[model samples]
Target: MDFASLMTKEISKAKPSDTKDKKETGSNNKYQRRADVEAARIAAYNAEQEKLQREREEKAALKRKHEEDELERRREREEKKRKLAEESRKKREAEEEAAERQRRKRLGLPELPPRASEEGTPVPEEEDIDDEELIKKLRELNEPATLFAETHKARLKRYRKLVKRSLTPQLSNGPIPTTLELVPEKDMKIPAKIPKDIDPESRKFLFRQLASYFTMLLEEWAIALAKRDTSVKESFSGRQAFNAMVQSRDNMRPLFKKFETGDIDHTVLEAIVEIVHCAQERRYVDANDGYLRLSIGKAAWPIGVTMVGIHERSAREKLHESDNKAHIMSDEVTRKYLQSIKRCLSFAQVRWPPDDLLQLMG
Candidate 1:
């Protein structure tokens, strides 16, 4: 092969190699550009992902906070309801206790002395009284009617005259005498001035007869009170009705004062009043209309006494019932009753009688 031809072939070969090298370099450049673009796109995608992740985390935290807040609110509402229920339960029990105490008191049950087994028993650690000393004290206090026989006889005569005058039909229109005397049992004597119509047996009746009449009067008064009616009429003669009312008010002053000061419970007062009224009538009064009608005389007294006893027993039983069924009374009701009673006692001047007369009055 000629030298030119060899040179030409080498040139051609060189040209082909140069062209291939260029193509390869171009491809590498294009690849590098594509790689750069891809890198930039990847970086952008990564950054966007990071932002999206942050946003998702924030959303999850917000959801968690909202759920926590809702749970807290629900818990607070339940707690409030529980507290209200507890308070209501306590109030009801107090009212029931007050009512029971009043009923027992009104029925004339002996004022319940503190129990010996309770913390405040009055028993001494050792006995201090001797049988001999007790007998001496009793003997000293005793005195026979014989010591004043003559004075007693005169007094008895006067008492009989007074009683006769008081009971006489003619004297009914007149005012009752302020002072009264008692007749002695020994003076079974009829007065010289006794009416011709008077029987010897009737005249001989002593203070026992007067006591019986007084008991009858007491029964009548109790019946009137129970019925919420006055014994005296609007046009009745003299001030007897007024005087009786005044006396009742005076007797009940202590109780009224205690109620006013909130020292006494209202439930107790109401129960006592109801019991007394029922006992007086020898029957339960209609609570709705407040009506009571009782028969008069000796037989009624026994009935009244029996009814009073029943009331007292019922009151004691109620105390036990309340304790066993504590949930029955709502605390709110109990508190309301207590508060109402306190206000009524303080503002209203209602009378309450002495303990000694409670049984008789009923």
Candidate 2:
């Protein structure tokens, strides 16, 4: 009994100490849990902050790239605009230069130097050259060494004029005179004696040359007509004359075709020469009359039909006019040629005054 009682007392004393130790352990555990929760919260907040910072950096970098691209596009546009403007300027300058050259040529002046050559040395003035050098230059230009009764200043002036004239560009064949002489009737007429062995090409070339001279004569006649004092009331006649000339040129095409085939007609050539000669001499009345005669012959009937017994005896006794008509004009190809010549005659009669009255009118 005594031993059991003592053991029970000892257990009762150990129970309080066990209870205190359990309480302390529980408090320590609770403190450790609080500290762990705080540490985890701090780590999560730091991670969130780092993520936000990275997003901000990406946004700033993207904005900077976009700005750089925009700037590059703007620069490209400006460069293209500058290039177009420069090209337009160069084209305009070239056209203006060409117009200036044409104007100078028309005015009978020396052409301006090309843009590339403008920077080169300029031509020396007449005053800059001495007498000996001037004489040498004159010889080179094939000009007279000196003029009779000419002073030094006068000689230099003459040299300058000659040099300037030489500077003008020459035609490939030669310089064409401003005023060309009228083609002679003999030249206009086809040759009487033809070479038997002449080539077709040579004959055609000869015909073309003759046609060109004919055209030149017409141009000279037109120039003379322009120089004359004409009335404004005759403008309609002038227009009609111009139309007739255009039609005549077209009509001549058939004649040219015939000539090309070596079918030479001297009668037609003589008629044309007569008309051209009259026009060149300013004898428009005679020219018009000749044109009418060539266009319409004096024959009453084109077909050879004599007056019958039903006709009056006086008609039978009447003498027939000469049969020198160009029957070729009645052909289908040349029918329109006569018509155009007739129209020209009609206009010429109204437009040109008589030779006697021309001087008074002028």
Candidate 3:
């Protein structure tokens, strides 16, 4: 009985103590679970934040790449355009150079050599003749005069008729027939014999004498013209006189020949008088001395015998004085006079006396 009672009391005390230890252990486990839960929540929040940051970085990188791509495309387009423009310019230049070469070939022009120094250096090439040089050469050839005479002889005859109409009075008798006639090439006679004895000096003398005689005849014609028309004394202009004289084939022909030979003779004086008379008739010369009178017959008579150059002191002086007198007239008158004189001189410079004596005299 005693042993069984003691064992039961000890067992009951041990049970109570074991129950208390179990309760304390359970409380400590609860605390540990709560702490673990809080830690897990914090880790999840941090992971979410890191994910968002990564997405943001990736988006930024994509945007930057797009901008770079756009810039690259723009740069590529500009480069292409520049290249195309350069190519076009080069092609145009090549075409222009080819065209120029073709034009030169067509014109039979030689290719120019390149200059050693490109700056300001002319290419070595043949040049075309200048216009002035061409004109001078043509004048030297005297082809223009010959052609003009051949083509315009009828016109010259018409001009002569007009001069006669203006300068001559209506006579009781009808108009006189012209002594001169244009001989056709078919009718022209060839010389039967050549004069072997005639030296150059003698030929020149004879030609000069012939010219003088022609001039003398022209002077007589001018005097006759002046006497026939009283209107020449009434109204006179230098330009009108010059024009009238120029219009007459008979009066102008001798002067034209003299001018061609660079000879001013009595005939030249008569021509000048005719010019003055015509001018006076036109009322261009308003000077006090009755329109600057010049005697063609008197001035030219000495040239026939003197065997001197036609452009002697007397003729030159008279011409100069007459020209000076003409200058004082109206501007229109002066201009016409100068133009007429130029035309006459030009004609004379190229005209030649005929080879035949009769033709030369006419």
Candidate 4:
């Protein structure tokens, strides 16, 4: 019985040790499960972070591409606008230049380029270069080497012309040059000075208006003159004579009667004579008296007329009156006389009339 009881106690103690080992094993398994769950949660977080980062990078790349495309389009638009503006400017300039040329042509003046006078480049001298060198230079300037069998002297002249053309760039496109003599400004025609009381701008305006009026008168006279027959200019009954009377404001007979009766105003006669005198070129002679002497023109003169008094030299002198001369005039003489007056009036406006010479040149 005692042996059996001891064996039972030993078995009981062994059972307790086994129970403690099983409990320890269960605690270890619980700890392992918690570690595995934590690892899985951390891994899932890392994957989500990576996915978000990739999405953000893709969005940034798309935004940059859109911005670059927008910039490119904007640059293209600006370039097109600039080109159009440049073309418009060039077209306007060309049109203005053409109009200016036409105006100068009508004025019987040279068509000069814009700011031509500002270019002070000297013309190349022909004497400085030989023919071979000159030919090369001409080619460089896009000019012909020589004009049809031109002489050496002619070539030199041509070279000078080319040099002048190159230097000026704005040479006038005028008709054949006139043979009119160039008078010195101070010694030739003196411009009328502005009176102290006169407004300069107003005077200038009046002068321009008067000039325009004179141009109209010239056109009217030209139309009348065109009808005149060239063959019988000297005949009293010729078309030329008839047209001359027709050209006058009224028939000149009344004017002659007024002159004979000494009834015409001095200002009216002076104005008439002043207009006629413009046809003839005269120099300013400091020594001469105020009276301008008259010489008979090609027209047949009336009998026994020594001279026709024109300008009033002083207060006592009366011009364009028949008080001191023969009053008879045929249609032929009258025609030429009126024509001379018209010629004077037809002359262009000049800046040489004195301030005191009112209505003398307008």
Candidate that scores best on TM-score: 2
Model 4 ranges off by over 4 Å: 1-37, 114-362
**How does each model score on TM-score?**
0.22, 0.31, 0.26, 0.25
Best by lDDT, which number? 2
RMSD vs true structure, all candidates:
33.5, 25.3, 35.1, 29.0
Q: Please give the CA lDDT of all the candidate structures.
A: 0.43, 0.63, 0.47, 0.51
Please give, for residues 245-317, the per-residue lDDT of candidate 3 as tens digits.
5455343444334433545543333444444333223222221122233211122223345435766554545
- Find the 10 residues in a row with the least total lDDT in model 4: 171-180
What count of clashes does model 3 give?
18
TM-score preference between candidates 3 and 4, better one: 3
lDDT of 4 by residue, 1-362 (tens): 69999999999989988999999998887666778889999999999999999999999999999999999999999999999998998899788888888888999888765644435543467455677987887888888888898965677678878889767524211111112222222333213333446574543333333233333444455555556667665566676544543454343334434433445544334433333233223322210111122222223333554454975334233333443332123356544434444443333223233333343532
lDDT of 1 by residue, 1-362 (tens): 99999999989888988999999998977666768889999999999999999999999999999999999999999999988887876566556656667777999766544325445444353533343443353345452222344443343344445557658633111112212233343332323222446564553342223322222333345454445444334436324544554354344434333432435432343343443333333332221112111111011122233344334643444434432332213344433333332222221112322344332322
- Model 3 earns a TM-score of 0.26
**Distance from true position, residue 36, model 2, in Å?**
42
Error of 4 at 176 (Å): 72
Q: After superposition, how far is residue 93 of candidate 3 from its true place, in Å?
A: 2.9
lDDT of 4 at 42: 97
lDDT by residue (1-362, candidate 2, tens digit) is 69999999999999999999999998887666768889999999999999999999999999999999999999999999999998999899999999999999999999898675545444467346787988898898888888888866777778888878877743221111212222454555544334557686656655654454445544544564566556732688776655556666577566545544557565565565566556545566666666666766555553455656785644443245545564445687767755654444444444554566542211
